[model samples]
Target chain A: MSEGFGLRSLHPSVLLLYYAGGITFGMLLFHPVLLLSGWAACLIVNGHLDGGREWRSWSLPMLGAFVALILVNPLISHRGRTVLYYMGDIPITLESVVYGATMASSLLGLLTLFVSYRILMTEHKFLFLFARFSPKAALLAMMAAGMVPRLRRRLKELMLVQKTRGIAVSEGTVTQRARNGARLVGALLSWSLEDALQTADSMQARGYGTGTRSSYPAFRFGPRDAWTAGGLFAAAGIAFTLWANGHGYLTIYPRLESFSLSKGDVGALAAYLVFLLMPLGWEWRDRTTWRSLNFGK
Target chain B: MNLLRRKINPKLLVIPIAIIYLVLAYVSLTRGNALLIGIVLVLLSMIPFVWRFERRQRQARELVLIAVMAAVATVSRIPFAALLPNFTPVTFIVILSGVVFGAEAGWMVGAVTGLVSNFFLGQGPWTPWQMFAWGMAGFTAGLFAHRNPSRRRRLPLLLFGAAWGYLYGWILNVTVALDVGVREQTWSSVLAVYSLGLPFETVHAAANVFFLVVFAPSWIKLLERYRRKYGALQRTDSGSADMEGSAHGQRTAAE
Candidate 1:
């Protein structure tokens, strides 16, 4: 119902910085332990951020997915040295289970980060930040993103219309449901064709793909953004340098090895924490402002 | 402008265009050597259909129709592998585009459907084949843009829809074979791979036929109702005049 985050409020610079940081984090610090920790932190933060009903609804599904991943993944990937038991041809292994958990946690972490980012950024800001480099592509991307909610609304309306016409979509058997689905698809396509034509006309009229465009600069790099970017770059550079100079890359195959955390690793992790905290700082600032408003009481 | 002169309707182009696409797709599948050439021809053919359609109609309305159809088709494909095993809703969506928006709308819908759907599915050389196949199906459906009940002749239309599904699968197989550099590109190899896809193809055909039967009548009725209510259906000459006036208004406002 809330339709997630409003991208309009955040500075484009912050969004870019955050996005860049996420990519770097994914590529560089992709260890099982670090990934799990980050994922746990993200879930805790997101759960707090998403207020009551939404979190309540999501919790069960999240737990189900987590359990399914942990249980099923180990059964398929039984290639570790530490074999726990053998169920016929299938060899259960402690290493494989741990490795699976790591992979699942990493996926969950990445998903959480993406969901948070989606909530925080608006399409206009997203386009504005990226458009200077590629206006046509960026505009298309923005339109594509904006179109999702519109289509969802249209689908709901179509569903209601179908229902009123005594098209018992829910009450049907499997074959009947499939038939109903086919009919719904047809109706949706019909409406979509008309909508697409109108949208294209409007876009074309406004000089879309005309090779000329204008911009309004709404995002600027404040001190917080600058510090975050600088910290992330320095951390990434040092990590790359160390890895290039023979620092061990963590391997999750065959067996799990605890890589000794070097000085560089420690520094990189600290910087990563700072990068993560940037959003928290903004939240704190907002909370402080709210508290200050109640000073008279 | 005379308000009663009969003009060559672009809506009639859908049937022949669909036939051409089906032929190309069928030929390409049965013979692998012509795969590249067939794709290029099909894509190139779309330009003329689109150009002619734009010239004759309110381009804005048509463009919107294309965008909406394309977007819906793309969105529908996203949840297919994610949600259902034998899902092929985009095929039905393309058909719906043709039935509702007319022939040109169907063409645009097909083109955009192929292009946009590839983003979620991943893009490759096969993208062009997909675009052409889906686009043709929609375009062809638009050709039979009449409101008569006898037009509801189900069997032939069902067969036509089923053939389009196979045609799409066949072209896609050719693209895959070519990409993988299968040196022989023989009938056996194509048959072996496409045979495996028989279930999917069957589902695709069944879905399209099911959709066509259920919603086609009601959609035609709705279109007729709209035309009668708004007096949008015009005598041929008057239609052109209205189209031109609308186009002129759009051009000025855009400038």
Candidate 2:
């Protein structure tokens, strides 16, 4: 179950919609508790996906950038009334610090979500979404995506071949190296141009865009996907309603707004937490099911 | 004459809309919202326009040209990824695409390059914005292509490339600022944001100028030669028909 059922098993539209909603809320909501919860959920989900190894490398740089943002916000932005400190005529305040933290949380949450997205949503998934809109554009995008790594390897080969010929880009003055680089690109252009012509001929022969085309879909929108999408929309609806009503608004401006909790706040928090944890919950359930089935087997 | 019947200059419309969006984004900063709705709106509106621009009857040669150009631009980012940080042949390729294939193709190539390259580099919030910036860069280049035909008039292309370097950096900086939520009405905070990014903008501009001066001529000539030879395969009659239709529309609107 764990191997078979995870975020990747979900329909592409479901996964895309989930990210769309999550990323939207992550960017728009500034409530501290909500943001911190979303950020934590992102970290945990990312940990489960990558076995927490990346956080070790990510911590140092994420911390550095996070701290830089927090410190820089207060120094440059002289907002709010509660002055915390002063340095040579500049005043550092609490509101800016809080604002910086919220901003950092949003930024980090977004980064984490995108990392997980990159792992789960493969190129075909993206192209599937694009192909629904425009088949030709998607084909072009597919070609371009496939061309990059190929060209990188080709460039490396070109570099080695050119190096042996004594016209390498690496071994020269800056201008000479640039000229060498330009030459390599020129050679690649003509080479790929001919290759592309062949491809065009092949595509023509295949009768592309001649009539209605059918695709071999790798995944289907099953009942589970529908249920997941329904749950997502319901959670998003509740969360958006709470947001519109100012249930958990955090204001850090000319004056710092005190963090308080109410009945509506609790509801908003619950809804948001459920929304953020939806994918993780699926993964956990699948993992547990896998453990039980394996033991029985 | 009905006011709605007036033909609008599509080229002139984009700049004013962009300026309005920027102004609204600036205002939103002071209004306590972290969301850059203005920029979001600008980008959202662009999607349908770009889609419509490409949903035309095109020859296989034109389609092949767009695909090849997008592939080249996407691939060109590879070798330079190590040589010059954040500087790639994408802009040069896209600009040359615009110059040779005209504005619609330019926009497609620019936008497609962003979408495809991010598959390798990883996509984020910046992906759509990058697409918009690169698309606009290509569109602007195409806007000037008619006047700057031939490799002889290459200075304007060079200047355009250099200007876009800073412009792309500035727009991306706004994305960062949106994250930071720097909404002070005074110029100091904005100045700080710009100053913090000044070094990067400088490097990007220098790289753009260098690439343009170095490779623009050869690439432009190569693409132009292709366009002249192969592009005319099925476009010879329809291309003129399109120009004549636009002229007729403009003339009727004048009357």
| TM-score for predicted model 2 compared with the true structure | 0.87
lDDT (C-alpha) at residue A201 in model 1: 56
Which sections of candidate 2 miss by over 4 Å?
A: A1-3, A53-61, B1-31, B36-39, B150-152, B178-182, B232-255
Top candidate (TM-score) = 2
- The per-candidate count of clashes, in order, stands at 13, 0
Model 1 chain A: lowest-lDDT 10 consecutive positions: A1-10
Candidate that scores best on DockQ: 2
Candidate 1 fnat reads 0.20
Tell me, by lDDT, which candidate is best. 2
What digit string (tens of lDDT, one per residue) describes model 2 on residues B78-122?
A: 556557676666777777777666666787788888888788777
Q: TM-score per candidate, in order?
A: 0.56, 0.87
